[model samples]
Target: MSQETLSIAGFNVSPHHYIGGQRVASGELFDLHCPIDQSLLGRISEGTPAHVDAAILAAQAAYPAWSALTAAERKPYLDRFAAEIGKRADAFCQLESNDAGILLSRMKHGVIPRAMLNITWFAEHALSLQDRPLETEQATHIVRHDPAGVVVIITPWNSPLMLATWKLGPALAAGNTVIIKPPEWAPLTSSLLADCAHAAGLPAGVLNIVQGSGAGTGARLVSDPRLARISFTGSVPTAKWIAQAAGANLVPCSLELGGKSPFIVLEDADIDNAAATGALMYRNAGQVCLAGTRFLVHSDIRDHFVAAMRAYVEKLNIGDPRDIAVEIGPIIHPRQVERVKGFVERALADGAELLWGGKPHPFGAQYFEPTMLTNLRQDSEIVQNEVFGPVLTLQTFDSDAQAIAMANGTDYGLGGVCYGETAHATAIAEQVRTGFIWVNSFGIRDLAAPFGGIKRSGIGREGGDWSFEFFCDVKDVVLPKKPFRASFSHR
Candidate 1:
């Protein structure tokens, strides 16, 4: 059965079903846990080595038929796929918000539209595939783009539906069959997506969903010899493990990993704008890999930025994610809350002053107030490590060189921001070692441009064209039979 055909409750009715030649959910079991309340969502059939073998077999069996379909034929499937998603869009959003502990407003207003746009972007790009022209001096030259066989997309829980679409959209647009492995913490949205795909009349084996832990199922998907490509988004440590496994199998993999990005406020930057933009660091409870976790301010304007930032953090409404005005929700889980607390405690121990919202929320239970810590030492853990929560650390720089140094000192370079006028911020953004940089904003992204981290942030690009390119192989054919070629050697 396809993910699209799954039950509304989010469990695969027959996780052990066979597609093409592969078997899924034979003897494996995976429990989906709600990150919001730590309740059990449901259990999916666990994927084992034998199951992985079957999936590879199924993908290989279906590849030729799926690939042979013309772009026009594939176009309808995409339209139907999107329609299916639209059918249960509300259910999907609710599940995603619940699973990620993100506000429903953000999910409905931000994530869903982006997910739909991703699909539309891929569909539009699919029709414009023009082959490269050969030089007149050559008798014959051809450049063809072909799909990589048997792709595996391993997605994280943070933005389950949206992130999965990022990988799925381009992979399918480029005509690759994919097996998606949803994160253990949030499989509900994926299950709904799978259902949509099936209802859209996509071929049974064209898309599959396998649920399990990163250790077993993730390893199996990465190590399987039949997979030609793997696209993964998660922590750096997990990306490392995936890279190693993919290396052993000699398969190409694309990774979107961790980040400890910085936001630099120049001496000329408007303090109010910088402070307001810095608040985005706490978006999604600061769980985003590209969140601007570090603040590098000009010593001249540092105190003003800190004071305004403290006031903003204090004013945030912290409560249930379902509440409309709740600016800050509970973290994905209590464990994440504890992790953020540990970071705060460590920062205080290292002599950082709590500027605002240091303690847990007065309402209690998995919610932490939006927090800002000033007087943070340059080398303190709060400024160094990624504290993926509603916490921002303050640091001041005497010179532009010091700002650059502090920003680049971390292992991450996923994102950076410079707050100033157009020309100056653009120049500074150019110097930051990051895949994405904004002049006055922090986390804005467009589907047209490629998005990925530099350094430890990630290893590959994701977007419409960039993602399609990642899933394709280029083959060049040259013929030297033309009259203009004196040396007829074909390289």
Candidate 2:
């Protein structure tokens, strides 16, 4: 491969879809660009409805054999897939960094490694499945978990590979074949994932990749009656559309959507650590769905917390993502930059105080300064909506109840953080309406814990045994007693 081209598994794979264990070109193609420098990365095959149908057909064909394999039998293949991904860790990190504009160092140390761990974890989880017995006086009953065939996984661009693994890991572990529709902006890593699966000797059509826009490939996949389930991670609006389409076919769906999460700093909290953790609002250019963009502080320590947060945000290194030293990279694209900017401008118009940076970074066209806002109404758009940018809004509350109320006020209930005395924090964490809450921490995640949101954030969970249930259908079987005793009704 030349500097201008990207190849996967020794194949010059520009402008093609990985379907039925082969790379096939489409009649049309879409240009992929590196957001870091606005450079053309390459073209990817523009997936159409016909392409989606082909991928679905392939997955359906492969499902019976794949699902028939025992958990013990499937472990080695999944383990080998993890091993292949580990072998190409550096390549994956670089590709994802270039494609998504995330810091290469972050990808190497965080995202890519997590992707490998996610696959291995789910593979191990598969072995733990067992049938449950239901007690009965006159009959024997057993509940079995079975695979839901032909799962469609639609992943978002910000953390594509990691999020894909969140869905694919269990979907495959539960013995379902998958068709992955990666966001067009970040399709390379997923294609490479298919390559890894192929090299690991995964059966053909067991895993397929279709690359295109949501309006094209994603819509078709959700509408396909052959699909048993759909797992989607993206915006709330898109998840709604996916749910509607899946509903038409009565397909089971797990959606992990957007968030306007909250971070509360109480008077008794460790101000220094709280500020450091709260600064995660700027991580991934604040593209993370679990980001704590809303800050609720106790009025007693509000000034001190604001000062600490401002100092921390000012020190974030904004530069080329390829540079390992840089902390903040470019936004995903120019449109995202504008979208983030619009949020800030609207907040200002709504009388929110611009206490810190609020404009594009002076160094890059797609870079926005980590912004901080204060004195905003709780119902303001900036506080209520998902900014999905390097922006944070601050408000002070008089009491614990007030803080909890403010945190739960938004339509989103994805993630929340409570920082203070452990007991107090834990108490508040329980009251927050979000699906996941942290006490004194911000972004800590455990694979064993359920992860998803409530309200407008999303529907259904996606980790631990929750994922197992989501990808599997449960059936109850009852066996009659050998004596076949009949009950007599009283006159």
Candidate 3:
């Protein structure tokens, strides 16, 4: 290991972090760096197939006690965990902001606080247990929610802690043992989360973590027969692989993948309001999964919308992650920066006009200027793919019906936004085919709502009680007064 490598609890580490029952130190290694400065952060030993096996075994071993404990028993641990997280909130925010190239101010004020809130939400949700009831002629029956066996949680680099907590909190609160695989690119917060749990006196082996890429570590975890469920947040290609593995093992899996969500600016929409709200696409440098990359504006107001958007993007300050005033940070990696640039180039070649920003940022390795492209072909790669960068493609539609149709034309149906007069936006929202749609807003998510995608965006759901169902199993217990009936209709 070089000076760029970090020493964690004695061993030299990579950007990736792992926490198996016994510490591991083998297999491939990945370099972690700051997305803004490209400075080496650390290295993590990429786990092998053997490592995944060991992790699954450890999780299986820990399941009994971890699942057997009552909600009352688990409450204190997460409560303490949340308190500790709050204590070091500043450090956690700083680490994530630097590593992921997220804006320091937003990370400190928005992302970090929301992550902590997720922990608190789960802690409180654990205390309240509610079940649905079914009525019958003879008697009443209730559906009981019980924890599934072992759970495999795979979280992506974008919004690492917040997304991980969304799965980790519910899975743990539901009493299922968990095995987490943090992204190699952003493992600091994941390690910090494990540390938080450890400091809160969580039992060893209850929440196991292994560091590695999606190919070996994550794939093996989902495929392991010991796992009863897999909760994953990543790309669509990887989600398909996880789904295949889960099917092979006959285990349930929940996936939340990429999106090319549309943000429609209706004819009657307030141009200023729409522009301001759509600016969130550049937030976190557009690394968010639910970012609105497709801007569909009604042709009647297309020119005005584009002008407002251009002005908004040109004003965004792009630079160091440490800058308090800088709203847009880097792309989180050189590869991503290159990918975003490539898309812009392709758009240019395909006859799309660059409305404002679209180039290597003046500052860092991962930085790309907030870019806006108009007159883009609907068939262009930039319009079809999820360009996870601070870039947006503006498209126009003749009618509200046409806008909704175009918005839902892709294989993805993750999220969308409708901006217009109150009545019109609400009307458009109804026709937009997405799991979540914002009225006059973009990228707004809540812990209480059901969050997920439709079609290619990914399957199943996350957040609220919906996620809890993924890690639970239902058993039908019947006590009949007469002999059991075999009729299709339970008469």
Candidate 4:
């Protein structure tokens, strides 16, 4: 293997499509650079429509046998896949960190483990699933979930492996083969995922990887009629395109798109803890879709909360992601650095006050300071749009109703936070338009809980039984009573 190649599980990680358990290095290759320093990482095989067709063919061929297996029978394969991922956790972490400019420590601690847990949980949970049996006056009804056919999963650059496996686990557990189109910006870990699957002896064509631009590769993937469903996590604009394509084929889609989530702090909230939790939103340089970038605080305690948050934001050790001690790292890419700068410039132009860091960090072209904006109007571009950078907005509300209104004002309703005494926070949380809300806590997740958003955020949910339903086609069967009496319908 060359220096560009990463060998995991005796397989050299190539920047090429893995179709039917073989490395298909066809087509012209595109260069992948490390986000941390813009160094050549690998030359990815540019996926073509032909590549997509091949993947579809492979999935079609594998679906029959894979779906025929019972949940109990399939668990061993998924278990082994998780074991393989565990064996190469270090590589997964390092690759993801280098590829995304996220802290290696963060990936080591959170993302990779969650990816493995995703597989583990779905594998075990699938075995315990029971169809609901209902007794009616004249008949008995049974609702069963049957596997949909081959599905396509389009993932985002930020937390690619975790997000992909989040959908992949249930999609596989529900007995659907998959074609994953990892973002070209960070395609390394996904290729490694295919390697892990292969190492686990997952049958050929059961899982495939395609890499390339969204305009061609992604567009072709979601539009394909052969896919039973399309699951995507990315920007809202791209989701609209995916929806249009999926709609043309009438293929169902599960979209987890962008967010402008809010974190509210009432006067009665624990200011220090609230600030700490709010500061955590800047993780991964604010690349998270569920990040609560909009902070709303009670006017009575606004000044105090701002000071607390400013102090906490300063404590973050922004440096190279390779350094384990660094808290915040560079923006995912130079383009994103400019995006944050544009937002900061426009925010200041819109008369917003810069309470804390806003300039590019000294480390390199990609590094950015964690920025916080105060005195921002609700109509500001920085307030409504998804910055996808280490920038945040701070606003003050007079009443609970005002807070809820301001929080719900954005086009997104993904995830939100309400910080206050338990009862008040719960009350406020209930009024926000988001799909999920936490009272006093941020980033706390329950494995079985459903996660998605409303409005422009996204459609459909994923997790637990929700994932089962989304990944499988549920049908109801009606059985007549033993007497087999026919009854006339009355209207």
- TM-score for each of the candidates: 0.91, 0.96, 0.92, 0.96
The model with the greater TM-score, 2 or 4, is 4
Model 4, span 287-339: residue lDDT tens: 88888999999999988998898888889988888798988887776777788
| Alpha carbon lDDT at 264, candidate 4 | 94
| C-alpha-based local distance difference test score of model 2 | 0.87
lDDT of 1 by residue, 93-163 (tens): 66776666778788878877777777767867866653554766546666666777789999987788889
C-alpha lDDT of all candidate models, in order: 0.76, 0.87, 0.78, 0.88
Inter-residue clash pairs, candidate 3: 13-43, 14-42, 14-43, 14-44, 19-209, 331-366
* C-alpha lDDT (0 to 100) for residue 326 of candidate 2: 89
Top candidate (lDDT): 4
Output the better candidate (2/3) by TM-score: 2
- Candidate 3 lDDT over 107-145, as tens digits, reads 778877787777778767766653556667764566666
Identify the runs in model 4 with alpha carbons over 4 angstroms from their true place.
1-12, 485-491
Where in model 3 is the C-alpha error above 4 Å?
1-23, 130-132, 479-491
Where is the poorest 10-residue window by lDDT in model 2? Answer: 1-10
In angstroms, give how far residue 115 of model 1 lies from its true place: 1.3
Residue 330 lDDT (model 3): 78
Task: State candidate 4's TM-score.
Answer: 0.96
For model 3 the local lDDT of residue 396 reads: 90
Going through the candidates in order, what is the number of backbone clashes in each? 7, 0, 6, 0
Q: Which runs of model 2 end up more than 4 angstroms from their true locations?
A: 1-14, 134-140, 479-482, 486-491
